[model samples]
Every structure is written in C-alpha cells, then in structure tokens.
Target: MEIAPGIYSMTQRKGAYVHAFLLDDGDGLTLVDTLYDTDAHRVLAELDQIGKSVSDIKHIVMTHCHRSHLGGLALLKERSGAPVYAHQWEADLIAGERKQQPVAWRPYAPVRVWPLQIALNLGVARHPPATVDHFVQEGDQVGPLRVVACPGHSPGHLSFWWEQRRLLIAGDAICTWPSLMLGWRGFTLNPTQHRASVRRLAEFDSQILCVGHGEPLASDAAQAIRAALPSLDR
Candidate 1:
C-alpha cells in the first residue's frame, strides 16, 4: 500500500505484523526493513504491484538487527545488489558474527508479545544473516531518509525522518499495535535510553508515522506520539 506519495508499506502477518517501507524518490527505490519471510516473496510482490522490479531497489537499510525486520535482507541484497546500511553496533549481529544480546525473560504486559519475548530470550528463529555495506549515524542521509539514532529497544536501534514528506519511520521505538506504547516492555534492552529516544521522536512534526509493527498513521501523527509520551513515565 502506498501510504504516502512515494512510500509503499509492506506488512507480513507474522512477526507482530512486521512492516517495511519501500521508497520511490523518483531515483529508484530504497527499502526500509524486510518483513518476516526469508524468501522475500511479499517484498517482491510489492515491487511488482508498484510496477517496479528488484533491480529498481538501490539501497537496503536496516532499523535494527531484530529477526522480524531482517528476514528478507539477505535474499534482497543478493538479488538487487543493493548496499545494506545499519548502525555499527548492530553490524556484527546482522552479519551473524555475534548473537543478538538477549532481553529479559520475565513477561511484560499486552500478553500477545510474550511469545516473541521468549523466542528472543532463547535466541531461536534466527534470520538469514547478511553483511552491512556501510554504517550510518544520525544526520546521515540514506536515499531520502535522515537517520535518527533511537536506542532503547536495542543499543543501535534507529528511526528515520523524511522532512520533505513530514514522515517518520520510527522502527520499534514506538508501536501502534495492540495499543500504542513505548515499545514491547520485555524486549526493550534499556528503558532509560528508550524513553529518551521516544521523547526525541515526538519532537518531529511528523504528518505520517510508519512503525516497525502495525499500520502507518497518516494524519495527526505528531500529536499521537505526543499523547503517548506521558505513558512512558507510568
């Protein structure tokens, strides 16, 4: 689905409605996160729907190293020959050089995500590993996005801003599924960092909010984020 003028949203039912974005800036395509299918059939189908092909994708960027988001990365990179970008802290994990640091074993609220928490704690259901071609930091541009380092869910978790479109691709720093919250409580590695990061995200004048999980918020996005801020302290 084209959520914005040139941004396409692709979602997979598994992995907590894991969502990805495909951007067309009239300069080929840039993919943000690949849903939970290792084969990448869904992403490929989206490209087809948009009347594009894998060759049209010029950059493959990652928000973090979580399995739900990295599933199609390896296959997409090989087929498109697109350079993959991510934060340095997450590079080794993406490359399979190291395991992702686990989260707490104790379950948190919104019970639907408990299974995922268990899976992560056990290091089960790993994604196909792929090498990152470059490491991006805050203020760096990846295609049409301005990288915003949002660490909390993970040390290197990231979000992106498209100033021209007033769009915020907020990764897992915020979720709208099963009710909006700071993030999945059990999966957050550092609540202090996450809280601070979300505060920063809320500062943007985002008209459209695309998250790692759940449908995109097309209007009043910035206000919605602001409304959720107080909950972080609860």
Candidate 2:
C-alpha cells in the first residue's frame, strides 16, 4: 500500500467508511486521519502491514471535525504519545470542550439521509475527544506538508498539500469516483464556501490526490479535480 516512496495508504473498505494514512518522514510516522475508534485496531493492523508499529506514529493530523475522520484519535494519541494537530476553529470540538453541530435536515430527503441522521443522533461515528497539540493554518508547514484552507465542510476544514511530492490530502474537500463529488451537502456547513474550496483545490499543481472516503488518484490529480468540480452543483 505504499503509494509513494514514503507514503502508505491504509484504508478500511477502500475508505467507504474512512481512511487513515501514514507517512514515514524518515524520523517517525505521521498519521493523517483516525477513521473511527473501533477502527483503531485496524489502524494498528495496517501499520503492521506497512512494517511500522504503533509506537512509530509520531503525530496525528485531522482534516476536519467530523466524527468519522477523528473517531480513533483519542486512542491513537494515548497509545503513541503523539501530539494531535487540528485547526484552531475546531480545536475545542476535538478537545471535548465543544459539541459538534448536527447536520441540517432537509424535508423529504432520500432514504439514505435518514440513516445518516440516525447515526449522528446516536453518536455512532463520534470519536472520543483528543487534545490538539498544535493548530495549523494555510501556508503553515506540517510534517513536510503545507496546509490549504478548505473550509466549508467544517469551520476549520483543511487539506494538506505536499508540494514536494505534488500530493494533496484533500480531507473532505474533494473525493474521486462516482465523479468528483464534494462533501455531503447535508453534512456540509456552507455550500457556497464548499464550492469555492473545491474550485480552489482544483487549481493546485498536484499529481496525486488522497481523500478521506474514496480511492486515491495516482496521477493527473489536478485534472481530475477540475473535471469533478462541475459536479458540485449536482
């Protein structure tokens, strides 16, 4: 699952539920997302698959405040003694001090929406709070990558930009397949801002794209995103 020289892609069900990533920065391992608390074991297993151990993970970075993305964060942090990095806007949310806002319900939606709502209400995907050791902003260097402010999915939503590798860890900002979709509108806080973010991300001179819930792109990542941006309105 080594997508790049030092990058390993560890996904559960091809990220249908969630996906976490590991980067061997030569010094230590850096984890991208935590998936879910229940999936922490899977993370460990995946780490083993990549010839890395739990203790090797030096840091955990969150893309946004959604539960599915940060579910196993607390457990991972506790086990590895790694500091968690998040955006300042949602740092409190990750710290257990602030509660997440529920998705806005649209009347008479499709059948799929109901289950999504039920899960949220039941806190099914919610993760135990993990402390944020650092808050990142656009242009800040984070573990060999730069932060790209892609808010709209969440107040402090971010996408990691690895300029040297030309890889973009888009968080929920963009997803491939089923044709370049934006974050679920029901779950997103602002459609206008989301659209803007996606458009902005498409402009990156990237060759690979990684997301929280879809297959990763090996090449032509920016072209795919440009093609997919139009689908945002659909």
- What is the Cα-based TM-score of model 1? 0.98
Quote the RMSD, in angstroms, for model 1. Answer: 0.7
In model 1, the number of clashes is: 0
TM-score for each model: 0.98, 0.89
Candidate 1 residue 115 C-alpha distance from true site, Å: 0.7
lDDT of 2 by residue, 72-136 (tens): 78889899999888899989988878777767666222334456555665665656877899999
After the best TM-score superposition of candidate 2, give how far the Cα of residue 207 lies from its true spot, in angstroms: 1.0
- Candidate 2 stretches with Cα past 4 Å from truth are 13-15, 107-114, 121-125, 177-179
Expressed as tens digits, the lDDT of each residue in 65-151 for candidate 1 is 999999999999999999999999999999988987988788787688889988987888988899999999999999999999999
In order, how many clashes per candidate? 0, 0
Task: Evaluate model 2: give its lDDT.
Answer: 0.78
